[model samples]
Target chain A: MKWCTKDIILFNKEKEFVDTVVVPLVPISWDKNMTATVREGEHITILAREIEHQLMGRMVEAPPFTYLKSESMEERMKRLKLWEKNIKESGIGYIFYLTSDVDWNQKNHNMLDMIWLPAVPLEHMEGKARDAYLDETVQDILKVITESWQQFSE
Target chain B: MSNKEHDVTRRQFLNYTLTGVGGFMAAGMLMPMVRFAVDPLLQNKKTGKMVSVVSVDELTDQPQRKTFKVKKVDGWHEFEEQKIAYVFKKKNGDIMALSPICTHLGCTVNWNDPAYPNEYHCPCHGGRYTKTGINIPGTPPPAPLHVYDMKVKDGTVYLGDAHPRGGA
Candidate 1:
């Protein structure tokens, strides 16, 4: 479910059913010349949106956590941990962190499931190639999410 | 009467009459626009409009997933969205159209997961519901799967809005 008022009402009423939360970690850059970083940010946002659309009934797409490019990794990690704790306290059973930021070290954050995707320069790609690339990425993420659910059930 | 007094009275009368006529004309022009804005909001949201989903002959005892597109209005924006439902025929010959969305968390539930035969299984938190869309208590689900308002005509199945059944 999306983080909209209508969906949130349903989520609140059926909190037990809404167990999975997917958080998108996006990196923003203040540098004017960092067009690549900005493009990557847009790409990750699209990827996250696609994931949410595909698994709408199963997962709540939390508002994205965007960190500045200049921010330290330690600070971002700390913030993520806090978010994770709060989500868990709210009775969420499964939390998946989706990111296309290469600088984000998934190894350090073991508290939540992290899906790291390589940044694809989508602006350079065209037509069928871009669609195929997006479809492939979504499928990969779907596989990971399903596997995580399977593991949780067991 | 003096000429100035007579002129002043005529001007005042014209001013009052013109202002009143202008106000009435503006209200006349605005009435339909105001109604147009509020009419949709006042109309019954449940129009009971039905859209054909699948053919009755295609349905079996096993629930099958069917996807259909429907136009949805969110405030001023209107767009078509794909909706999913699980359709099946009960043993008693009644056609059942169950919304795939799990009542617990709004996740899509799959019918007849190999692990749980004859039941809808939610992959998100392992929420389960019986074939009849009744939630299995003690699980995560707080209510049963929503059942669509369904009707069959000439072997074609049509569905309206889905209503959630409180927990079993």
Candidate 2:
């Protein structure tokens, strides 16, 4: 029932502190030079679970999730199996990390504001095959994110 | 007023007005120059720049390192040739494109090195990109070499600027 300028602490059905999240928060996107910013006093009435779900959705939307590097022995093996099966599965791969000043899940005008995901077909053993996979992966990712947002809003 | 004083006043006023107008007109002419100087600040200069490689037919999927040039357009001027490298492929009768610029530091990368046959090596700073353009972090490159946007028509490949690796 109480609120602070920056974050709001929500009480659960049991009157226990369920979650404390920054207010007026925009999740990080996959664009460059994005800063995680918060206002001192902004509040919204929403379940902590909903926010967490949205946050995870945003994180899933971030880049590097769909990138499958075949150079790694493990990745190579995974791709080999996928290639053999010819079945498509989705996953995330992080090859490098950079220190960001913003919240890792903030959304901005461009996805780069939070994370830069370049989805490629992770199973292609060859270059063109990989490009086609990338094209498909991107299309699928966009669809998933769009559907998630619509479902969350509803 | 004395005749000489009157004449001097007239000339001085004319000189001041003429020079002032001339200066104003000159500055007006240089508006484009001013904009040129300050435009980069207001613009995101690093977005979606295309680096060209070879025609799609010249590059093969077997991983050959081919060096080429991209004719870049800068304002009203065009640079004849800017060096670039790429790997090209025909996958199931489809053309695909890749860049040889190391994702780490924009260095030209070599593929299928006899010494390090398993990896793509950058001799400049010992950075290594995988055959698929993944930057091995411990190496010099901070990221992967970019991939150029491309289209194939009649077997000729037209490339766009290098975009961030993965999918950007």
| Alpha-carbon shift of residue B56 in model 1 (angstroms) | 4.9
Tens digits of per-residue lDDT for model 1 on A52-120?
Answer: 776676678999988898888889888989999999898888899888777765446666688888888
Q: Of the candidates shown, which would achieve the greatest lDDT relative to the real structure?
A: 1
Looking at model 1, the pairs that clash are A17-B104, A17-B105, A18-B105, A57-B107, A58-B107
> In model 1 chain A, where is the ten-residue run with the lowest total lDDT?
A103-112
> What TM-score would chain A of each candidate receive against the reference chain A?
0.91, 0.23
User: Tens digits of per-residue lDDT for model 2 on A22-111?
Assistant: 122123334342222111001111211122232221221111122212134355335434432331222221111211223222423231
What lDDT does the true structure give each of the candidates?
0.82, 0.44
In model 1, the number of clashes is 5
Compared with the true structure, what per-residue lDDT tens digits does model 1 show for residues B57-79?
A: 89999899887667788889987
DockQ of each: 0.31, 0.01
Q: What is the DockQ of the complex in model 1?
A: 0.31
